[model samples]
Target: MRVRPMLLKAGGVFVLLVLASCTLSGCWDRIEVNDLATITAVGIDQYSDNLIELSLQIYTPPQGSSISMQGGGSKGSSSQNQSTVISATGINFADAVSKVQEKVPRLLFWGQNEVFVFSHSAAKQDIAGHMDYILRVPQIRGSALVFVSRTKAKDVLALTPQLRSSSADVLEEVSNLKIGLAMSAGNFNIMLSSSKGTAIMPSIEIMPAPEGQPQKRYPAITGCAVFKDSKLAGYIDDNITRGVMWFRNEIDMATATIVTEDQGGIISARLNRGRTRLKPRISNGIWEMTVGIDTREILVQNTSNTDVAELKGTRIVEEGLKQEIEKRMNRTLQIVQKKFEADVFGFAEAFHRKYPKIWNKEKGNWEEIFPHVQVKYDIKTVIVNPGKRTVPTNRMEGEKG
Candidate 1:
């Protein structure tokens, strides 16, 4: 009887404790969706010497909308003007963000944020410090795309995306396609970590839309920002950017146009697979690096005399292609080494990896050494297809024209 009574009391106390814990846990970390001020993109512009302009695209929740949040497009905006974009000035990024929120009624939430565009004025300034702000911030997504806008950063964000709700999605897919060099906070992290203290970022320009189009258009990559020791060194053209891509072994979907003396027309080849190997050697106490690239090609466009039946002609075409590719790669190397004086190719990293002892002795003089580093290229290309033409379309001189 005594044991039964004690068991009953213990059971009642346990049940009460369990119910209380459940109630507490359920209520914890709960925030209403209505309270979140969703920021789609953050744009920074140089306002003055002492202050910077910040713009935020914020979504306004509808009061009586019945559409579900899971739907592809947001029904949160009640009308054309319901969604809002606002701007404010502050000396620092955090301050600017806080000021922008003062006018916004809801709490600023960046979990859905997708991009940060630095104005040309802002980017022209020492942006290592500015980029640092984004790196250290906890609320921002690292995957968010980073762009250097040719025009004001705010204008890029204001271009209304017709199909998508935000420009972020468009840029995200563009970066993935390797349309040019990938420039994002995540990629910046890798760039910042390079031992050579150089980084390259893709430059995006805004162009006028077609006559009938209301919105402005963002064109393909045309420029690259060069960085030396975390400061803006200068910018390079698209050709140099392609060279950089080749050296970095990150070339994707690049078509090379090669002209052969024997071939009547230009033969274009698209690289399917390519690998760049950096080999370092010490010759007579001097360090040298060789960049070997192995590429497999598929014939894309042939506008010349393509002889499919003539195996000898195909061989000649392949040799010509190999020479052309090698020439382009070597030319790119010269610009990077002799002109740019930028070790964007990781020659230093290659040396450090191969000859650590030599690197220790020569690390101090890398700047002076890079320009003189004996770098050579060996490119191997295999042409797998001849396109539609197998036999000679334009016959040899012996054959009838």
Candidate 2:
């Protein structure tokens, strides 16, 4: 009974301290929504004079319309000023973003931000350096998506998307679709932190607007940004990008078009799944890696053959596509290994995993040895459907019966 009373008295003192702190207001890190500005999207481009072109997309309360009545009132196509876009040129990201606040009526904020883009020049010069602001900021969420732009980041964000309210939101949704690599701050950081291999971020390009269309245009995901030790070595086309995805086993819905053997036509195969197995062997001091890829595919569209109108013909198409896919994948792997001399596919990681002791000795000579690494690709494909109609969807007008 004496011990119980002493414990209760101690707990009472802790409660009093907690209440006192709450009454004294928040801690030193306190920041309110209205007092601080929100930044929706940020872009960085390299300027010639040791400067940077930084662009910011800030969310603003609807002008001439209340928040509750947004997109619901009887007005036709509501007002245009939902958010603000600003760009500044300075020596760094912080300097540029700070300049933007001078002109904008509303305070700049980044709480609802979604995307961060770096121009090709910025990425090539130094991507990690320019992204320092985003990495350090406590308010800026680490989940924001990242991209490399062909043009200035500001020009890309100025586009008026017909569907989404924010261009940043448009890209956020696209990244989840997995058409390309998942590129966010967290993902980029992880890849940078990886030991053996480097990370690849998707490249964004702006399409020319048609005559009478808007001056600015929405950015499109074009290809992959190849990075070697936090710096961009180069970029690859879509075909090479797809090939890289094959090695990583990230291909879920890729269409492969193959030329028919007997007839001069094209057969497009839709890949359902791609599974890859990499095995490394040391033969007489020469490292050999076998890259076996098995894939399941279906016939989506055929533009070449006509005489073969049976379901059995699908099997023949499958085999042809399998060979074509395999050949292309082999070519890509060979080029990257021998020509680019960069291991973008984690081949080094696989080698290090199995032979840790041997890898340690070989690590010093990896760059010289990587170009000579032998890679073998094996691809298998399967066709599932031939549309709802089993027969040919199109028929010749005057056929000789």
Candidate 3:
């Protein structure tokens, strides 16, 4: 009888332990997705001397339906509006965010934000200061793409995109294409924090509406903002930005069109591959840098009489490609290295890697020496494919006629 009583007490204790496990596993503080306002994009602009304005593009679902919080939806749909923009002003980014939260009825959630745009004025004022607030917010993504807007960042956010769900969606896709300089907030911060203290950000501008389509204006990556000492030094236009990309070894796709002076016609070549190397040398206490470019291009369109099958004709096209690349790079160097005097090309880092001791002594005066650094280009371009036709179609057609 005593043994039977002990067994019954142990069984009751086992049941009690199972009940406690269920209670511990319950999600008591879980936030419902329906109650959170998902932020898809954010913009920061200077409101006044001490005030900063924050704009958020929030994703709003259809009125009656509750969708999963996975941020999946058709973009640029003609049927329903998917998002809304809200703005608030405060002393700093954090304070402005708090003000924005007050205006929003639902809790502002930044987990889905994909793009961050800063107005040119705001960038020039103090981007590094603003960047601190951005990184400190644990909810925001460090991988979010960043851009500089020529006008108010909020205006860029407000533009109605015809092909995308929102302006942020449009920006995210374009920046990924790498046609212009694409930088994530994390990499941007690293660049600013580097010893060289130089960085570059893609610049966006509102393009004119297409003919008879006044409501279809959209933002475009038209140039780049060059920063020196954590401040906006100047900008490089689209053409010059391509050269910058080449020097940075970031060029993935490009088209080179050159006028064949001897043939009196035009030839356009598509770059299949491009590589750049920076060789820094110190001879007799003189710093000289050589930019070596190795590229393979395919002839896409040729109105010239140059024959791709013939060795002599191929050399002509190759020579033209080399000169064209040199021209673009020289123009870029003229503006960025000489005019802006901004070391956006990582020359300081390159020198440091090659000559550490000398760099330690010379880095303090790098800004003064950067403009005077001698640069030479050793470019070699080869025509990998001349397309299906060995000779110009136009020339062949004329010859037959």
Best by lDDT: 3
TM values, all candidates:
0.84, 0.83, 0.92
> Top TM-score: which candidate number?
3
Candidate 1 C-alpha lDDT tens digits along 100-160: 8898877889898877777777776656666777778897888787777777878776765
Order of the predicted models by TM-score, top scorer first: 3, 1, 2
Residue-wise lDDT of candidate 3 within 1-401, one digit each (tens)? Answer: 69998999999999999988999875997678988999999999999988989999999876534332244643434346678899999988889999999999999998999899999888988899888988987988889999999999998888877788789999999988877789999999987888455899999999888788676789999999999888888789999899998988999889999999888789999999999999998787788889999999998998877787787888999999999999999999999999989877878888999999999998889888899889999999999988888777666455731
lDDT-better candidate, 1 vs 3 = 3
For model 2, the superposed segments whose C-alpha errors exceed 4 Å read: 1-32, 67-81, 99-108, 195-197, 303-312, 395-401
Query: What lDDT, from 0 to 1, does candidate 3 have?
Result: 0.88
Off by over 4 Å in 1: 1-29, 59-84, 162-164, 308-311, 387-401
Candidate 2 Cα lDDT to native: 0.74
Cα RMSD to the true fold for all candidates: 4.1, 5.2, 3.5
Off by over 4 Å in 3: 1-29, 65-78, 397-401
